[model samples]
Target: MSERPVSTTDLDSYIADLRQLQARRRPAEIPDHVVYPAGEITIPAHVSHWAAQRPATTALTFEGTAFTYPELDDLHRRLAGWMADQGISRGDRVAVYLGNSPEFVIAFLAILRLGAVHVPVNPMFAPAELTHELRDAEPGLVLTNRALASTVEEVQPRLDSPVPVLIVEDGWADAIAHEPFTGDDGDLDALAALNYTGGTTGLPKGCQHTQRHMLYTAASATTATQLSAEPGFTSLCYLPIFWIAGEDLGILLPFVLGGTSVLMARWDAATTLDAIEAFGVSVMTGTVENYLELMARPDIGERDLSSLVDPQAVSFVRKMTPQVRADWAAAAPSSGTLRESSYGMTETHTIDCVPYGFAADDEDLLAEPVFCGLPVPGTDIAVVEFGTQTPLPLGEVGEIIVRSPSVTDGYWRNPEATADQLVDGWIHTGDNGRIDEQGLLHYLGRRKEMIKVKGMSVFPAEIEVLLAQHPLVESVAVVPTDDPDSGQRPVAFVLPAEGATVTAEELVSWSRENMATYKVPLVKVIGALPMTATGKVRKHELAEDAAALNR
Candidate 1:
């Protein structure tokens, strides 16, 4: 199987056909000036513009502490100045290893202001996981809080060279007292951030994004999600700031629109509800797990959630059902409707499809199990024959490919992987889907061996490699099993070493100790593994077996 050669004429026709589909499904016109030209403006420039125009407007609210636009801009500028004093310069990587706090936002802006690339590290990462990213990114400085300082220290020795660690709590107070940064704005094409995403074959790879990419994502997300562009437009942000979605909504969107974001250090149903009620949050985003947890809150019905307008969610953890949507609408009448569904990846910086403004009872949306709405403006999507890149006709299921200004430049330090994923300006998304006649994307499933647990990508190969290290394990096959609350959970079919005894509990426990919580699989011991004629484990059969176990 290989990609078929597509002629110039055929390609042009295919693109025109895609545009027609988009026109059919296009939502209302985006408000004027809501979406800025891509590659023309940087995020720091947005901040500066908003600060100059709406200096007194509240820009962020975290745990009762608020920062106005001017104050927030000044803090980031001062932090950028402090970072420069520490020898950081253009193109240097600076890792932000903090959770969803005000410090994370400050650090993010500071890095971008100084023309340095931001490296967002998951605060939940264990030492081994953190070490991999540090070694790969080789950041000049790591910014973390006191709580997670030990995690950074533990991984410091593993790096090829010693990197400086700046504790957020200890450094912020003094940094804010220094003179603000008066440096030149970073070039639009210069690298802005290195977002790490899990690979199908190995450890996570960093997606290299530039200022243009980030600005484009923020603009498209703002317009596509239908966020209010007015000042005082409040949003609840409990999502991790380290992730692309979190960065877009919690930091970029609010700044771009001169709005206020109420941040939570971590998600707790009670706390989230309280913040929503107290701040009159108008917009928010979350995964299925977060929504489920909020719905499960006993006092959910009594809360005043009338402030919510356009809440968005991804259904990777579980399919969004009519009942769930109804329940959500009932809980927040002002929300006017259930959360709009969208599709994106780290490679795209967050958003690709925007379903906002689509009727809740649209027949096409109801019929398609994975109906992610039309591509946002300045973005194009197509379904092509796998391997060959030949354009498939409308309604034909094939590999979903994307061409957008927001797509990552490529993977950092992995030219081979970059070549495989990015080709001729189109990102070869491993996802399989078809563009229906109505212009909506109907997701089939992944074309690769990957599992999404609680909206986080988990690869079987990564887990298999870790479990193989167990002394009593001889062979292992990891497959995704259906999960109601989480989209899918990993299940391990294990073959114990000859004459060795290992209980499922023991292996599960070992996995908990060695891997991230989301990567640990439900272990099932098997006497022998199903194999193909070529001597490879039959993962499809294992997936079926795992599904059967659920029944």
Candidate 2:
């Protein structure tokens, strides 16, 4: 098969362009220093800088509405003053249950400005799950959309601890009066946000990150990916602000860099395409599935997407099929625009990203699709094999360990789980990857997702990719189940392409022909595959459904 069309000048051109852009903008040849002063990391600081530099420039454009830098800055200051007057003390956690809107950004930044940690509650969570997080965080207050207040109220009376809840409604009277109140500047060392991630034992654990941690994350990400606006650059904010990748790059980084952000409350293929052409969006970050959906649209080819600097960003580790990579490069030429891939977990502040594509002579960079690039400035990374716990040689697949100023201190009060994951000051990134001779990183799989079949280790992601190539297969989710006889067996749940059909036997035969016998799933179900909001298949749910099907 012919190799996919890719820009040979990818790395060379990117470095040259970025270096030139930096040099012309900065008096010194050094990379532009993002000044994040000590003592307090507040939204007010970023907003103030942007307001002073580009007061009239649009800061955010959401659903046909726009807010300039000064407008957003004024709102932040006023909200902060009101919050301080209402006695929301520094370091207090405040839950926010709101959709993607102007108020969402205002509320989040306002909470940060008041030196309060914002607990971003998942809007999709059930009342029980929502209540549990709220109770655990024990936030002093909650800022919720008027529509979601009922859910909060329903869970309120049942809680052992109650918190004051305020409604965020446009044109409504402020819950905290506009009267000014003096307050202390936030201590940057203080906690900034508490994001919940999956626990090792299948429970939710909060990851507390400080201002410096978040700042470092955003700075490093922007630097590594070269996320910039270049005067009229526009970015599509499709992912929810709750996701670290979306919030850091889509929202926070734009403001810090004085860039225009176009927002969408939800993802709709046709609407997303229309918005891209209408708003002249230059960049967007989303999964390959999203790009596929947009491209499948009948009118997509006719749409004027030349304004896009990158068709979209792809996760190499999650969706790194040779076909997928080829499709992306063809759609957005590496020399014309870049779709950089990134590697990082929630704990490390979502740091580390590498520009995409490799040329004939650039064999060094092509060694890993999960090339998160070299650690940004203060970060460190090491690859160690699983059994011996010894650092592995470059090019050997192993666990990717990291230590950085941005790494979380520990999970919230979970000492046992913390001890198991963190070792010798390194956060054992539950992720398996390898470093190439040229220093690029490649992700293999997550430790937790490793499946054991007949005493052999198998990665579901590897199997899923092969299954996805089948003509009838629209998507696939794989998991391991105990077989009583064999230690475990691979089981797959598949979603067929619309209007197409495939039997379990035929699917199994196809998989057998494509993958190794051990890797082939013994149990196969043809049906819809459950997915998260961000388009990642919820493998745990599929596994449960698969078990029930066999039973």
Q: Relative to the true structure, how large is the alpha-carbon lDDT of every model?
A: 0.81, 0.66
lDDT of 1 by residue, 128-179 (tens): 7788899999999999989889988887788999899899778778977779
In terms of lDDT, model 1 sits at: 0.81
TM-score of 2: 0.72
* Clashes (N, CA, C under 3 Å) per candidate: 6, 1
Show model 2 residue runs off by greater than 4 Å: 1-41, 170-172, 175-177, 180-185, 228-230, 315-340, 356-372, 385-389, 450-551
Model 2, 274-364: lDDT tens digits are: 8877877767876656766665677765777777765545642234355554655565343134344466777887755343333223332
**lDDT of model 1 at position 111:** 91
How far in Å is the alpha carbon of 143 misplaced in model 1? 1.3
How well does each candidate superpose onto the true structure, as a TM-score?
0.91, 0.72
How many pairs of residues collide in model 2?
A: 1
> How displaced is residue 384 in candidate 1, in Å?
0.7
